[model samples]
Target: MEVLRIILTQSSANYKKEETILNKMTYPLPPFSTVIGAIHGACGYKEYHKMDISIQGKYDAMHKEPYRDYCFLNSIGEGDRGTLVKLNNKNFLSTGFDKVAEAKKQQGSSFREGTTIQVMNQELLTEYRELKDLLDRIKDFEENRVDKVLKLIKKRKKDLADKKKKVKENKEALNVVLIREKQIKELEKNINDRIKAYKVNEYEIPYSNFAILTTSLKYYEVLNNIELIIHIKSDKETLMDIKDNIYNLKSIGRSEDFVDIKDASIVEVVDTIDGPITSEYSAYIDYNLIKNECVFLKLGDKITANGTKYYINKDYVIEDNKRIFNKKKVVYTSEYVAEEGSENLHFDISSEKSYIVNFN
Candidate 1:
């Protein structure tokens, strides 16, 4: 069978494991789904394409990198804490926010009173304080004036209903009372609409520009000098597209994990071989292949070598507006051997290349 063989390299990368939180952990290699997604992205395919991949790679070293994590609060309350920021755009959290001030003391530091706080940007601080004052005024108006008017309207409606009951004996006068009650209801609705417009424009819209954000230090596990050998098995058209746009494959693990394409070619490979072939690089081997003895793990005096079992993600289908991934169960190891007449293992037949392909 002819398969697309790609050799790639990255200076630094973090193929993050999904379960990790504070310290973003990195996988031994990029998962199956990551490689597939990267390939589709490079080709600029809008939809998922059917393909199977074999990922094997090595990294020079591993290290922990530090970064700051920011968590923004949904709404500010009395005695607010954390760093105060003025958002460049309303109602969206992006890199477009300017730091107005931060609490010098973690607790009991007031952003509004400017107590024990450092003002980074005086203009933004003034803007934030003005917005806060406007919000307070809006709240006071709603409670003292708008709400009182609504209560008076309700009481007037009740009084009209009482007057209608008293004039029940006179049909014409009762009809007039009902008409006046209807007019009062219409006036109340207009007042409510006006109040809503006032609050949305004066309070909610302006308040969205200011946010209280908290920060924490976190670390990421980064792999350095990554070398990856990927094999792609798909239709002829898709393979040709990838080969044509091989250089467009930018990153695999993260946006910062930029890739450099070394080689891209079609190579003939055979599932059955006449002699033993051992893996030269660490690879994700199908667990079923290991279970059936198609691939053996033996090195030096160790007859039974063990490897880390990973349920690596491959493809995914969107169900209920969320992606449900198809995971492949594989064993990650460098010490794997494939002997004569193997079912799942493949040996590259290229005269200049020697590779043991274990597609999971």
Candidate 2:
């Protein structure tokens, strides 16, 4: 029987037709009884028809009591017809299960996306806070350094002021010393000229004569009168007599009485006699009286003179000395005479002494 069943099952279309007919009749399909029904129904035998009807009637009564109220039937066909029964309770359960699966999938995708956004936001917040802290620290550092730099600048300014004050004081003191030295040099020159003119070997000259001579000559007019004058008088004779007697009458002089008697005369004659002179045989030079010692006129300096050349000296005198040598002289002696040539045309001369020559 099993061999014959295997042979009959080889025809699939015939088996499906019998299965469809049995399904529509409301048969309770047996466990392992599909083969038997398929064979009997496909054979279409009269004896098997009676058995199939009886079994189908019993299946219909069972279905009417329970499955018939909730079940529905539908047919779908592709190449052949097929019947499908749907239970209302099964459809509801299947729809609910599909909805739950879809929701789970959506929730999983959303959870992954949300987690990534949250992590990124946290990292950004952390970076922003760090940057803010760094900025605050840098600002504080710059402020503190600026304060220190300002303090240093102020101190430098104070130090510069102090140095400037010291420099000013030093310059003032130097000017005072220069003025004093100028005055002293003027006085010394006047004393030396008087001694040389009188032919006095002694250093001490009468103070009375010095005062009278200096005042009458008007030397160093810029100096205070009181500072230049000194008083030294004797009952026997004047200071001029003392100076003449000490030098053994080596210098020329007139009576002090004559000067005193002519005191009321015109001031022009007295001034001319007392003024500086550059006469022959005199040690004094006239132009020396006007020039300052610190500032000398060179050869290129502009000048006006009657003679060949004249130079200004670096000292001043109030009176002329009669018995002195003033002019310079030069002498040349040669015995041999030679023809003029380019090699002999030039002459070179060197001297340690400086000659005073004027320029105009």
Question: Best candidate per TM-score, number?
Answer: 1
Count of backbone collisions in candidate 2: 3
Predicted candidate 1 versus true structure: per-residue lDDT over 266-286, tens digit per residue: 988787776777777899988
Clashes in predicted model 1? 0
- Cα lDDT of model 2 by residue, 1-360, tens digit: 000001000100111112332132221211112322332333432342211100000111122111122212232112211111222244342332111000122122221122212232344334333443554554575467644655655565566455555666687765655555555556556654654554333211221111100001111101010000001112222223332322221111111101011011101101112212221110111232223221122234422222112221111224475423222111111111111112111111114211111110
Clashing pairs in 1: none
Range of the 10 consecutive residues with the lowest summed lDDT in candidate 2:
1-10
Q: Report every candidate's CA lDDT.
A: 0.86, 0.23
Highest lDDT: give the candidate number.
1
Off by over 4 Å in 1: 44-48, 158-174, 291-293, 299-306, 319-321, 340-344, 349-354
Error of 2 at 19 (Å): 85
Estimated TM-score for each candidate = 0.84, 0.13
Backbone Cα, N, C clashes tallied per candidate: 0, 3
Q: Which stretches of candidate 2 lie above 4 Å from their native place?
A: 1-120, 168-360
